[model samples]
Target chain A: MSDIQTDLQAPLQTPAQPSEDSGLILPRRSFLRGAGTLTLSAAAVAMLAGCESAAAGTSASAADISILNTALGAELEAIAAYQVGAESGLLQKPVLDLAVQFQGHHKEHADVLAKTVRSLGGKPVDAKKAYDFPVDKLKSQNDVLGFAAGLEKGAVSAYLGAVPLFKNRDLAKAAASILGDEAMHWAVLRNALGQNPVPVAFVS
Target chain B: MSMRPIAADAIGGGPRKGAVHRAGAALRRLYALPLAAAVMVLVIPAEAAAAPDPARGQQIYDRCLACHAVENNRVGPRHCGLAGRQAGGLPGFDYSDAMRAAGFTWNRQTLDRFLADPLGVVPGTTMTYDGIKDDQERRDLVAYLLSLKPCAPR
Candidate 1:
C-alpha cells in the first residue's frame, strides 16, 4: 500500500530554491515542486489499492503477500513523512539531512522487500507519488513532533509484526536492523519535542 | 473371444507358473525404486555440522578486531581468551548494566546467538555490531577467537 504510493511518487523533480528563511534542504519537496503537480499514476494507484485489498485478507495468499505489501508501504510512508518534515522549514539542516539519509535507507529496504516478493512469485506494489497527510492540521511544533513520534511508533509496530512472518533469514535481519533505526528516530524526535530521550527504560 | 484349449491350459497349468514369476519380478522392481530413493535421502548432508576453516575465520575477524584486541582493551574489550570466559567478567572494564546483568558465560553457542542479534539476545547490552550471518564464517570467527590465548606476564 505505502510502496504503491511511493512508487507513484518516484522520480520526484527538484523545485526552485526556497527563501533563506526556509532553512531546509528539502530535497524530496524540491524535487516534487520541480515536477509542478502531484500525480498519482493510475497503475501505481491500482497497485496500492490491490495492496490494501491484500492487507484486508481478501485472498487466500493474503497473509504473506499483504505483509510484504505493508512493509513496503510503511517504508514509503516513512520516506514521505521525512520529506514533509524536510520541506516544511521546521527542522535544521542536520536534521533534514538525517531525514534524507533515513529515507534512502527506507528506499533500500523497500527495494529489498520488492525483490523478495517477486522472487516468491508475487507482484510488488508501487509507491504513490504524493501521500495525503494532515499537514494543515499540524499547527504547532508539538504537532510536528507528535506526528514524527507516531510515524516511528507505527514503523516499529509494523516491523515487529512483519518479523515473525518473514520466512527468509535475511529479510528478518533487515527488519531487525531497520527497527533499530526507527527507534533511534523516535528518540531524536521525542527529544526534539521536549520529551524524555529514553522512554520506559527502552533504548528508544 | 471365447477361451480356447491353449488358454485353458495356460490358466490350468504351465503358463500360470510363468505369470507368477513375472508378477514377482514386477514387485521386486517396485520395491527397489523406493529403496534407492530412501538411500539417496539419507545420504544428503545436514547443513549445520559442516566444519569451518580457521583461515577463513581469521579473515572475517579482521572487522571485529578493529574495536577489539587479542591482548588488551581497545575501543571495546580485549577479546583474548574469550571463549569459556564469563561475559562482563573483564576486570576494570566498564560494562553496561544490562551486559553485566546478563551474567552469561561466553561460549560458542551463546556467542553465536549474541552476534546474530545482540540487542535481541541481551536487551540492554551496548555492543552494536550487526553480526556475521554466514554460519561457517561465524564458526570460523569463534574458532579464531578461541585460539587466541592470553599473553604470559613479563
Candidate 2:
C-alpha cells in the first residue's frame, strides 16, 4: 500500500458500527477521526512535496533536524509575539493589519519547517501553550511595536546563525529566505515606531 | 612508419641517441599545446572569463536580504556606496574590529574574494554569513551590489 494508506491504517481501529440516532448510517466517530488524519497528511504533503514518511529512517542528518527545530521554535515564538501584538489593542488601523500579515508569514514559515522536520524523519517540536512575553510592559503602541521589532530582530539573528550551520545547503537557503522576511518585518516595524527602519549595516 | 624507430627503441636497449632525441622533441611538441592553452586561460580578463550578471546576482542577494539592503541598512549596512566604500566605512553601524581593520576597498576583486569567504577575509566580522561559494554566483552578487546607486545621505 502507499505510505499515506499505511499512515491511515495505523490510526484506524476496527471499523465502528453505524450510529442509529442521527439518521445517517455512517460510523460518525471513526469517520471523523479518519478524516482528521487524512487532513493532516494532506497538509504535510502539500507543504512539502516528496517527503518521506517519518516512519522511514532519517534521511537528513541529526544536525539538520536540530537546526530546523531551532528555527521552527523561533517561528512559533514570532507567531505568538505577533498574535499578542495583534490582540493588544495598542496597534491602530494599518499597524494592526501589518501585525496580522507578519503573523501570517510566521505561520507559513512554521508550517514549512514543521513539515520539513517530519520529512527528515524527526518529530517537529510543539509550540508551548504560553509564552513568557512581557505583556505587562506592552502598555502603549510604541511598546508593542518595540517588543515586536525586538523579536523580529532576534529572529533575524537566529536565522543568520542557523543558515551557515545546516549541513544541508537547501536548509541553509530556506533559513536565509526566512531571514530576509524577518529582516523586512523588523525594518517595517521600526519604521512604524518612528525609528530608523534600517539601523545597522550588519546583524549579529 | 615514422614512429616505428621510437617504438623499437622502447624494446631494443641499444643506445640510439638520434632516436632518443627525436622522441624527446615529439614529446615536447605534444606538451606545448596544453601549456599554451593554460597560459591563455590564465591571462583571460575577469570580465571576459565571466561577465557579471546583475539579474542573477539580485536573486542570490535574497540570501543577503536578511541583514543587508541596497538603499538602507537592515540588519547589515546598506550596499549604497559599496563599490568604492571602505570595508567598515559606515559611520553609525557598529562594525567588528576585524572589518574595521580589514583596510580594503570594496571593488570587484575585493568583493569577490570576500564574498567567497567572509570570515577568512575579515575574521571576527559581526556578519554571521558563511559566504557564497560558487564563482559565478559570487560574481553575480557583486555585480548586483555594484549596480545599486549610492544612497543619498539622510
Candidate 3:
C-alpha cells in the first residue's frame, strides 16, 4: 500500500525528451514503478464471508477488506488519471477519442471495484477533489499520451500483483481479464507515442 | 443478488469453475523461487557455452527478463515450464483471456510466430513485449527458454 501512499504524496515523474536514436520512453518512474501493486475484486466480499463464517470476529477478515479497498483506491486513481488527461484541453482528434475510450475502460474497472467493495461491507474510496497527477507536464499531446500510457502500465502491474491474491479462482481470472485490457490500453497508447507497442517477450 | 464477471471464459467453460483462492499462496510459492536469479544467470550468456550459439539466445532473452520468471507470476506468467506446455495451461497462473483460449502448444514454431508478433498471433494478448524482429534472436531465445524447467513453485 506504500505505492498508494506514494501516489498521494506526489505526481508522476516527467520522462525525459525522446532519444534521437532508439526513441525510448523513460516512463514516469513512480507510475508503474513497482511490480507488486495489488488489484483484487470480489475477494473482498467472498473472502470476508468465508472468514466471518469460520471465525466470528477475527482481524483476518478486516485485512481482506483492507486489501480490496486499496485495490478500489487504485482504480479510482486510475480513472482520475484518465480524466485529468482527457480534460487537459491539449488533446485533440484521435488522441481525444482514444482518451475517452480508455476513460470508459477505467470507469468499467471502477464500477466493478466499487461494487465489489460495497458488497463486501467496505466503503469505496472516493476520488480526491484533485489528484497529484503530473498535470503541469501535460504540455503536449505526446506528453498526455505518455502520462496515460504510464498509468495504464501501472494498472497492468497492479492487476498482476492483485490477480494472484484472489482466493476465488474466478475472481483471479477476472482480475487477469482486466489486466489484459489494461495492457491493451498500454500498447495502443505507446503505439500512438511512436514508442514500441510490444517492447519485450513478456510485459511487466 | 450474485454478480458475475462480464468477461466470461467462453471457451474454458467459465473462470475455472471451483478454482480456490487461497490467501498468501502466491507469496508462499515465491519463497521457493530463489532460483529466479539462476534463471537470469542461465538466461543470458554471450559465449559462456561452447554449445550451439544458443548461448547467444540468452543475451536476447534480456528483454523478456522483465516480466517473466523461471518460477511464478510477475507482470506475466512464469516461463519456467513454457516449453511444450499448452497455451494458458498452467494451473493457478492468471492468463489473458486470449491466451487461455489460444489452444496451441508452445513449441518452436508457435513460439517463434508469437515472439515475432504477439499481437498478430494472439490477437488480444496483453503481452507488452513488442515482438523480437530478428529471426535468429527469436530462435535463440526460444531455445534457451525451452531448455529451462518449470522449477515448481513450492
Candidate 4:
C-alpha cells in the first residue's frame, strides 16, 4: 500500500511549494532495459508479484475496505442531511429541487461504494437511519442552504481522502468523478445562500 | 565431454550455468529486481518521479478553471501562493470539513498521489476530475500547479 497521510486532525503545517528544482521529486522515468534483459526482468517481476500478494495482501485490502467504508459513511450522512433539509419545509421549490437532485447523487455514491465493498468480499456497512445534525440551528433558508453546502463539502473531503487509497485506478477515478459532483453541488448551494461559491484553490 | 553432476548450490548460490541454473538465475538477478521489492512485496509501481512541464500543466489546468483560479476567487479558491500553502488554510474559502481536517503540506509526493487519483488519496476533498493517470502527465500537471504563485508568508 502507498504511504499516505490521511489523518484529519494532524496539525496544519506549511509545506514546501511544488517545483522541479525542489519539494517532492516523483520518480517517473522508466528504466531503459536491454531487450536481452526481458527474461531476467520478467522473472524478477513475477517473483516480486508473488511475494507481494502473499505478504501484504491481507492488510492492504483491509485498509482499502476501511477507507471505502469511511467514504460510504459520508455518503449516507449526506443523504440523511438532504432528507432532513428537504422535509424541513424551509426551502422554496427551486432549492428543494436542487436538494433532491443532490440527494440522488449521494444515493448513487452510496450504492457504488456498497457494491465495491461487497466485490472485495467485505460486508458493506449499513447507513444510519438518522444523523445528529443541528436541526435547531437552522433558522432560515440561508442556514439550511449553508448546512447543505457544509455536508457536500464534507462529502468532497471524504471522497478525496479515499481517492488515493483505492488500489484500482478505475475506482479512484470514479471517486474523483463523484467528488466533482459534490463540489458542484456545494458551490451551487453556497451561491444560493449568498456565500462565496468557490472557496479555495487546491482543495486539501 | 563428460557431463558434470548437478550441485545443490547450483540452484542459487552456485555459478550461473546449465539449463537449471539458468532458470534460477532469472529469478536471482539482483540487478533486475528492485531493491525495495525484495524487502516488500510488489513494487508500488513508481510512486513519484518526474520533471515538470508547466506548459503541459498549464494546458491541463484549464480543466480546473471552472472551480479554481490562479489568484482570484472563482467557484473555488484562488491558486495564488498555493505552493507551501497549508491544507485547508485558505482564508476566505469555505473548505470542506475533510480538507480542513487533513493536516498536510503539499509536496510533489502528496500532490502526485492526489493527482493520480484525487479521491484515493484525500477521500473527502471537493476537487473533482479523474486523476491524471499517466506518470508524465501527472508530474507535469503538478509541476504546472506548483508554478502558481504561493501564498504570502504571514
Worst 10 residues of 3 chain A by lDDT: A29-38
- In model 3, the Cα lDDT at residue A152 comes to 67
Model 4 CA deviation exceeding 4 Å by range? A1-60, B1-154
Better-scoring candidate (TM-score), 1 or 3? 3
* lDDT digits (tens) for residues A31-67 of candidate 4: 1111112221233223323333332434436556655
Whole-structure CA lDDT of model 3: 0.53
lDDT of 3 by residue, A1-204 (tens): 233333434443433434545545434222222211323334543443333333323332443343344455556656676777777666666567677767766666667656665655667656555544546546666777876776566566556544544444544565566677777777677766756666776753
Scored by Cα lDDT, where does model 4 land?
A: 0.52
Best by lDDT: 2
Docking class of 2: incorrect
Per-residue alpha-carbon lDDT of model 2 for A1-204, expressed as tens digits?
133223433332222333445444323333333322321233433424333342134435765675566566556766777887787666665667777877877787788778788878788867766655556566666777777776677567557655665566656666666667777777666666555556678864
lDDT of 1 by residue, A1-204 (tens): 343333333442222443434443234334323323322233433343334333333332433554455466556655676677666655444445655665665666566657656655577757666555656544443455566666665455345544554444444555566566566566555554545544555421
Q: Could you tell me the fnat of model 1?
A: 0.00
DockQ in order: 0.01, 0.02, 0.02, 0.02
Q: Mind giving the per-residue lDDT tens digits that candidate 3 earns over B47-120?
A: 44343255787655444422443453433456676777876677665566656656656777667667665544
Candidate 1 wrongly placed segments (more than 4 Å): A1-62, A140-142, A202-204, B1-154
- Relative to the unseen true structure, what is the C-alpha lDDT of residue A149 in candidate 3, on a scale of 0 to 100? 71
Would you list the C-alpha lDDT of every candidate in the order shown? 0.50, 0.58, 0.53, 0.52
Instruction: Please identify model 2 stretches exceeding 4 Å from their true place.
Output: A1-59, B1-154
Each prediction's TM-score versus the true structure: 0.38, 0.44, 0.43, 0.42
lDDT of 2 at A23: 46
For all the models shown, what interface RMSD does each have?
31.2, 24.8, 12.9, 23.9
Best by TM-score: 2
